[model samples]
Target: MKTLWVLVIAWASVAPAASMPVCSGGHRVNCVVDGDTFWWRGKKYRIADIDAPETDASCEAERRLAAEATSKLKDLLANDFAVEPTGRFDRYGRRLVIVKIDNKSVGETLIAAGLARRWQGRKEHWCPAP
Candidate 1:
């Protein structure tokens, strides 16, 4: 029937529009929010598969490491980089992504540098207990 054909066409047109936005090509790094997060083209992104010390750290050692992590991440993002989405989002609504600088994962770089740790479904302390 003509009506059925029209309905089918309308549905098909709307389906693509309703799909989730994909970040494939990547975005320019606008600024680093912290060690594990950054802002890109007005969107907040969290580094995937890694966790860094909180900027508002509780202890002196943690605070120092947090600052170091932030600085290191900033330096990395200063170069040409791309963000590949992990098909996930954090609780804070940040897009989870693996930041690649010169084709190398920034998260892995930070981990190797002792600036961050691999995320294991939970946050761990960056400073040893007293």
Candidate 2:
């Protein structure tokens, strides 16, 4: 009984992040370039804030999981909305954009959904007038 109870508590603690639904980031785009890259309007974009798992891994499970996450993000954004650059250029040279679906900022939406992290470290001015 004691061992079973401990196992249950451990599973409960890790479940939320694992079960978290894959949702769209507020900056909607066309597709993923890699685990960390994406495309929007003939331009390439890297996620401005979060460092997701790298595609390279010794374990196949780790690699597949990262690929799946990127695929899920792209799948959710397909044909769903229009987006504009946020006026910020990330270190990778992709223009940051405020994605809009039905006139909603995709960035805000993604953050709210816990799909993407708020990039408070990035300066707002980096997003150019668009």
Report the lDDT of model 2 for residue 78. 57
- Candidate 1 regions exceeding 4 Å error are 1-29
TM-score of each: 0.76, 0.48
Model 1 TM-score, 2 decimals: 0.76
TM-score of 2: 0.48
Candidate 2, residues 1-130, lDDT tens digits: the string is: 9999986554321111122123356654344654345665446765554444445655665466566656655554553555444567877688655544565654555555444455667422211244
Candidate with top TM-score is 1
Writing each residue's lDDT as its tens digit, candidate 1 over 1-130 gives 9999986554321111111222234563366777898777667889988999987788888888888988888777766676777778999999898877666888999999999999999889877888
lDDT of 2: 0.50
Q: How far is candidate 1 from the true structure (C-alpha RMSD, Å)?
A: 10.9
RMSD vs true structure, all candidates: 10.9, 17.4
Error of 1 at 102 (Å): 1.9
